[model samples]
Target: MNFSEHFLHFIWKFRLYKTLDLFCVAGEQLRILNPGISNTDAGPDFNQAKLSIGGTYWIGDVEIHLKSSDWLVHGHQQDPAYDAVILHVVHEHDQPIYRKDGSQIPVLVLKNLYPEHLLDHYHQLVNSIHKFPCEKQIGEIEAVVVNGFLSRMMVERLEQKSALVLDKLSRLTGDWESAFYCFMAKSFGFKVNEIPFELLASALPLQVLRKHLDHPLQVEALVFGQAGFLSGSFKDEYPRKLKKEYAFLKKKYGLKPIGVGAWRFLRMRPQNFPTLRLAQFSALVLKSDRLFSKILEIEELSDLIKLLAELPVNPYWIKHYHFQKETKEVKLQLGISSVHHLIINAICLFLFSYGKYADQPQLISRAIKFLELIPPENNTIIGWYKSSGLIVESAFFSQAVLQLNKYYCAQKKCLNCGIGIKILNK
Candidate 1:
């Protein structure tokens, strides 16, 4: 049976091998009382295991390798961390292994012990060239297992986003509001203009914007000016007035605008233009006393949606997509889809990150609850998973499938996935 050492771990971890009449290479009867916990750290493959050899019980670590000589190849023979290892399990016993103290480490060869079908199934799934390796067979698994795994995956997705939030928080000296402002700015960009939006946030700090929030026009001027949008000569009276207002504010605040080249507008919808997003973002700032604080206080998903959806954007944005450029009149209010995007990317991440940092499990729970309350995202990736037999009913499952696709299915890490393990064992 050809398999990686990870496959050996799976076999040993789940006890997917024959157990009757087991014996060590030293010719002593072996019985596994407990397989112990799988260790992710460097010390051992399995920790605190209990097993009987030659009518004597031993409790220590168990190290597995493709060959007995791998102990020396990996330099575990010299590393003091491996000194507590009591047994060496291998697929093939090429040579006897010894501790540094000259005592032999008992060896167990699993060459013909485990079921071969498990290895065969693993190979078939990993080696498949389809977009999703298990796409053809994933539907065969029970719904309970699939949903359970996806739920775990959704939390994993949140944890990953929380790490990013924590990193940003650290840079801002643990200020949650500032971190939220910057991240929300990035989310507003929605991939196409994310970088410029982030740069705009850095260029104009939230504190500076706070002082002028009472005057919505001045707030819009500062946001647009720092975004490098108001620098151009404009034919419109509103933009010209904003340019004049920004010229004074820019110097007063000692601010430098990001390059105009950072914004992209070649092939996007007129409504998603960076100019329009900045207008909406500025309105949002003017409407709130402290935006992140308001977000924290919001308990119900509907309230949170209402808070974002009811932004007081200036009516100028309703008729214009860019400065000096007027388009057909259109409503510039934040759409439900856009509000959901903010909730998923910005609100959920901050809630989860702050919860973790401040040791508040309730906030983390609320973050998850918010995702469950929202609808599933409509995107190419989610569409692909739905077509491949995965049931995505809400943002919770959609987020999980996104995480699973990027980290596991795309990378072919089948052995580490619960669904993959089930299919293999079946």
Candidate 2:
């Protein structure tokens, strides 16, 4: 099996190659003082590597390839970016490599220095047909190793989530409440109608909803109307009343409702219907003033849960999933599981982003603590890990495992993962 350049970078980064009797192509003794940081962007593979060669110390970037000829194959010799490379490391020293100035760069062949067994193990894991590359060996790894990787993975997931929050904040012109409102609206839509809900949120600004908070009817009218639920004729008094209120509000605010086609109802549970979700969302807006501010002040998971749960749909929605569609009366309150999902995907991420933007470490810690208090999410990916003998105790571990599975395991990035590195080193 052919190893990727990423694998070679991994081997070099961790000093996995045999160090005894090391020499360059010029027959000069070579020692790696520092392997340097791995560069993900254009230019060399690793940056600022420290090397001692023939009683001379050089500090510059390091470039690696499967073969020495790849230096030319990738056109790096013609680029000025490779001029500062202090060392050329490759698996095979098939040909000589030259720098931009037509000078020979010292080459370190890593083929025999690293253990063949480790490469074989990596190939086996990568070529495996199992859902997880390490399915068979995951149980054999130490718990501490797995836990450490999980903790790091969890933060990785949070950082990814924070990026989205940051982007939303930028789009909202630094309006934290608007960004939170858009994010919360998307979460309320769940997976089936996330886009339509986001569109609804964007079309109807948070400030508009805040102005109508004093009247729940007007709030529902604005949310439901902007969502395009009031477009068609309704046989119910509540929807007709909302329609009348929305007609006036739409004209006053110069608002246009999103197309009704944006929402999907097929195969979704009645409780998760767009109409009910809009009603619940309107209730949330009505109950909370400065929702993002309140979220920042939250100290406990239960308090956050209570804040989310306090907003229940009005009486009419208790008996109706949609306008003109009356069913048996149900509580129509947000379920604990759905609330937890929102808190995990929206509230915690928003808090984390706020903490990062404001430079408040305690807020960041609280956001992570909130995740710890929540239970593990039940999903197919989490189920797959559990089936493989891995225990998920909290949202933290679950989120970490999710990131590990999606970003590293599924992507065949074993060499970059701590678990995969441990497995390979063993």
Candidate 3:
């Protein structure tokens, strides 16, 4: 692998790429003053640096290189930033170089110092398993190292999602619950039906919903209306009644359906048809008063399971999918396992966000461990997501743990980050 390939390792190995170094280029001996921009997505890994060369210190912009010739190869010599570069640090030095203004830039070569083992480990990580790009055998990395790594990895994971979350939050008028509802429903739709589910959410409003707090029937109307499922002449007796109620409610509430259909049903397995699933979700909201707040207050996993079980759809739905398919009454029930999975996901997200407010992660851990006692749910729905490399295993009510070892953890970046001076000086 080339030195530029593992730039973070290079920076961390040597102190040359820091923002807190007082040093200058084109002089006898350079002193470091500052290090900047360690986590920026573009440009130099570092943004600002200070240093003195010999007895003369120049305070200006900073530039980095894997080798001296990279200056011209990377076309940095033509950039004005090179003019203020106080130090020129390289992993390997092949020749002298001058900036666009023709001022000679001083250089320090680092390839002779960075450790061999670190580079080897890097290749091992990048070249081994190709799925997640960097997830192979991270399972083998040491605990402390992997923990820190996963912590950062989790942050990165969340960071990638934050902008979308912020966007949803804005759309929901800054309501975290509404944003979360949209998010969960969309995720439940699992990529294929995501837009349909999001449309379902957008079509159904919370305020119009509160008008039918005591009647699951009105709630079903709003949900089915939002889903655009009312057009098919729901053939069963109960469906007829629901349809009548829906028409009345629609006119009264000024409700307009989103024109979505059974989203797709002919090819779906019996358990996952759009009608049954939406009914289940609608039942849940009808049964709970402010579902998220209740979820937040629930501390017991079993109780959480029962509370979910208690969220009844329509009593008549107990034995049917459509208001009346005359099928074997499967109880139209959510298994404890499904409830546990959702609860754990909600709990983890809550703790992840509000973790600073309480010392209850261990409690949450206990609750999650308790959830494992329940039997796992087997379904094509979960297996489909699993096949796609996303987390779908019931065990995920816990967390994704990647093990780390000396190859990654022992190196202290500032003392520990990949782009710190330690790797450069190693």
> How many residue pairs clash in each candidate at the backbone level?
0, 0, 46
Write model 2 residue lDDT over 276-368, tens digit each, in one string.
888888889988989999889889899889988877578887788888888877667789999998998899888888999999999999989
- Distance (Å) between predicted and true CA of 329, model 3? 3.1
Model 1 residue 209 CA deviation in Å: 0.6
lDDT of 2: 0.89
lDDT of 1 by residue, 1-426 (tens): 456899889888999899899999999999999987999988989999999989999999999999998888999988999988888999999899888899899998988998878888988998998778898888778999999999989888888888888888899998888999999999999889999999999999998998887787899999999988887798888999999999999999999999999999989888888888899998888888678988888899999999989988888988788886789997788889999999998998889888888898999899999999999998888887788888888888888999999999998889889999999988
Indicate the TM-score of model 1.
0.95
User: How do the residues 1-426 of candidate 3 rate in per-residue lDDT, one tens digit apiece?
Assistant: 253434543444345343333233343665565544453454554556665667675666556667678778888766664566655666666788876667677775555444566666555544444333333333333445533444554444333444566677677777766766766566445445667877887777666776787887778877876788776676676677767888888888677787665376666555566677777788777777566666666666677778766656566655565545645566576756556556544444543433323555664454445435544344543333234333323343213221111223222122344322222233
Better of 2 and 3 by TM-score: 2
TM-score of 2: 0.96
- Predictions in order: lDDT: 0.89, 0.89, 0.56
Per-candidate TM-score against the hidden true structure? 0.95, 0.96, 0.71
Sort order, TM-score high to low: 2, 1, 3
Please give the lDDT score at residue 9 for candidate 3. 35
Tell me the lDDT of candidate 3. Answer: 0.56
**lDDT of candidate model 1 versus the reference:** 0.89
